[model samples]
Target: MGPAGEVLWDVALPASPSRLPGATMAGFADRGRTPAGLRLIPPPAVTLALVFGPGTVVLSGAAGRGSVVAGLGFGTTRVRQAADFSCVQVRLPPAVAGAVLGVRPAELGGAFVALDDLWGRDAARLAERLSETSSWDERFALTDAVLARRAEAGPAADPEVAWAWRRLVRTRGLVRVERLASEVGWSRKRLWSRFQAQIGLPPKRAARLVRFDHAVHRLVAGQEAAFVAADAGYADQSHLHRDVRAFTGITPATVAGEPFLTVDDVAWPSSR
Candidate 1:
């Protein structure tokens, strides 16, 4: 949920009775004359979205329905929403995504796949079941069950790879990839390849994505670009500018005004 002039939108957590590990949930709806299109800036986690309603929800250039899984830093995306619609969006940790999705997150990077393709008829069943639900709480419970089942049955990430990923996230991506390899007792090449296979991106790019995510939020909070650059660990404002452009293709000021980033602000202003 984000940017444009005077467009209205809303964000909410799922109704109570929720339980999922390493997954953050948010529900979205249109209020008033929402914009025809919404941009999705890259984020640091994999995304799962369930969309239903009279209006169409387009992702990137493709119109989508049912459920979809998108990889982290999936580049610039646009969602066209209907006048009346409801979406339950979830962000999953990369390792959790690997287990639940049954594929390397790298396979989904820079792209999205319909859950139907991956889950087959089970995906269709999920869509139909969710559409029939009488309450949001029921819908969330069903979703949690499906993901929990997969996470339990699927293979886990290598412990070293998982630990290295945790370090990158904990450090806000400020940790050096070289140091990660050394600390994990693996050669740089081994770490890089394994990290990419398991996490959907090379260690360095994932770190950049995480760092950019933190820095961008500060920008949205009204901090100066220069200040965000320094505090967020960029070498300089120019470095920050380059990273911003690489991810969003817009300057810092333009990215800051984005309504997508502001939706969470409207729902949880304290998050900033």
Candidate 2:
């Protein structure tokens, strides 16, 4: 809680996003004395969390105060270390993730990869630069500039695949694959193949994840599970239960109290 007793997490956003055609960001800090367990919930996009500060952020059992990337999938990752780190996290939609990350999102295979693995020395240098930076605004600017440059220089998603992914996102994953394939003038097999190749997950899996993301947030907002299931397009409360467990390895009640989703509105904002 903040000084005023509001639901507060020391998180900030850019004054205005200069780039990020389909991305959102947040600046996060934790200062509890005890070690913190941050259960990262995967959204519908690729995530990059850049860490730089007095303490460490341990992901996938490796302690790195640098940066880590989380590709799209149903996996549970916890931060294991002192709870005194500041991080700038960015979530990029498939349309921009491939270009910004400079590789097919499929290459990540729903796992955690240190930024050094992909960007090498550049990642170290960026961490140092961010640590030296004094203001959150400057930090956001530096991160955004690098992403824009990378997007301009790197590979791009196929136009058809990009369109299909966007459709899934816009519809909250409620649209059918056949509808997308027909709209793109491609057979279902071809669309599935290309989307998996570029976006990192097959069409059905990606849609399920997207739908889960939408439903999870509603749960976090304090809605009853039965009501959320009906409203979120799940076939039944049991279906919602299965998805929540499959994605986070926890029940809906536990998910409702998670700090990751609790801080989402302030950190991520609902616009994008």
Q: Residue-wise lDDT of candidate 2 within 114-169, one digit each (tens)?
A: 88888988888888899999999999999999989999998888889999999999
Give candidate 2's TM-score: 0.94
Model 1 Cα RMSD, 1 decimal: 2.5
After superposition, candidate 1 runs with Cα above 4 Å error: 1-7, 15-20, 266-272
List TM-score per model, in order: 0.90, 0.94
Q: Which candidate's lDDT is highest?
A: 2
lDDT of each: 0.78, 0.83
RMSD of each: 2.5, 2.3
lDDT score for residue 130 of model 2: 90
- lDDT (Cα) of model 2: 0.83
Give the lowest summed-lDDT range of ten residues in model 1. Answer: 263-272
Question: Each model's number of backbone clashes?
Answer: 7, 0
Off by over 4 Å in 2: 1-8, 33-35, 61-63
